[model samples]
Target: MSQWFQLGLQNGNSPLMEQLTFFHDHALLIVVLITSIVTFFLSAIFVNKFLHRYLLDGQMIETIWTVLPALILIVIALPSIRLLYLIDEINNPALTLKVTGHQWYWSYEYSDFNDIQFDSYMIPTNELEQGMYRLLDVDNRVPLPFNQPVRLMITSDDVLHSWAVPSFGIKMDAVPGRLNQSSLMINLPGVFYGQCSEICGAGHSFMPIVVESISSGEFLKWLESQI
Candidate 1:
């Protein structure tokens, strides 16, 4: 869960997220440099009385402005395009989880295991226990093994929805009558939370996602118990 006063992005739990954070910093640095330079020029224009008559139609100044902006855009676009392709790239996933979004809740099916399916409902605030996060905790959690590739097949039962997890850098739409797929690989063992980004129905805020990453041995034990 994000705090009210927090302005920065959450610490990432996966490799993609780490790369995204780096890109964010890189873009911010470029923006800051551009802003500083523009501010300095504006201040100089207003404070300094030295005005050259040719400054208005200076060809060199115009050419430098156009070429500099183009070069800056190229610098920004290269890494951005690379990161876009990296996010879309999918490796061999060891497990596939089918996620279905309802009007108010999320249901998951692990077809890789025989008949393992469950619905995840948000835990009511009154029923929440100690250390539980309000509106973020769920009655059922989708578990995945850490350091392994997992693919999610997402779709909606009724209306449109979106499965978004910030730490994983994944946001895929769940449209009715259509199936969408995304991949995730969590390197650390912990709980990651998300929600339906698209507003679907009255209980839109009640639908939350909780993913619990654990060891492969524990995941196998859970699978056996489900069977």
Candidate 2:
């Protein structure tokens, strides 16, 4: 979860998010390097007493400017393409969780188990308990076993709503009459929070999403109770 004065992005709980964090740092470093080089040249142009006419027109400078950006793009594009493919690949998922977004709330279904499904509605601020996160907590949470890959299928009931969780690096749109799917694995065990990113209605901010990640043994116990 993100907190006040957080320096960088929230801790990544999924493998894909970890890769995303790495890619962010990698790209930022390149941008910083480019900025530093440009700044140094601009400073020299103003402060330095020496001036050369050849500096303004040169094939070497043009080649450097052109090839450098292309090379940098290739360097960044390779990893980006790999991550896209990785997110798309769903390998033998241990479970398939179906999600549907309504005008305000979210519904989840565990098709791998028999008749296990529920609606998750946000807990009102006035009804919140001590130590509970106001406007972020929900009456029901989508529970899943940690360290196991799961395939998520999403759709919408009425309007467009986006199911987003920052830690999991997932933000799938819930479009009516259309379905979207993604693969992810929670590497850590904890409760993660999100909300309906799209403005479906007036209650958009009140529609929150929660996920509780636990071990497989505890998940089985929860399944037994649900059954």
User: In model 2, which runs have C-alpha deviations exceeding 4 angstroms?
Assistant: none
- lDDT tens digits, residues 82-127, model 1? 9998888888899999999998999999968888999999999989
Candidate 2 lDDT over residue span 52-168, tens digit each:
766889998889889999999999999999999988889999999999999789999998888999999999988999989999999999999999999999999999999999998
How high is the lDDT of residue 120 in model 1?
92
Model 1's alpha-carbon lDDT is 0.91
TM-score of 1: 0.96
lDDT of model 1, residue 20: 94
Candidate 1, residue 75: the lDDT equals 94
* Best model number under lDDT: 2
C-alpha lDDT of residue 53 in model 2: 69
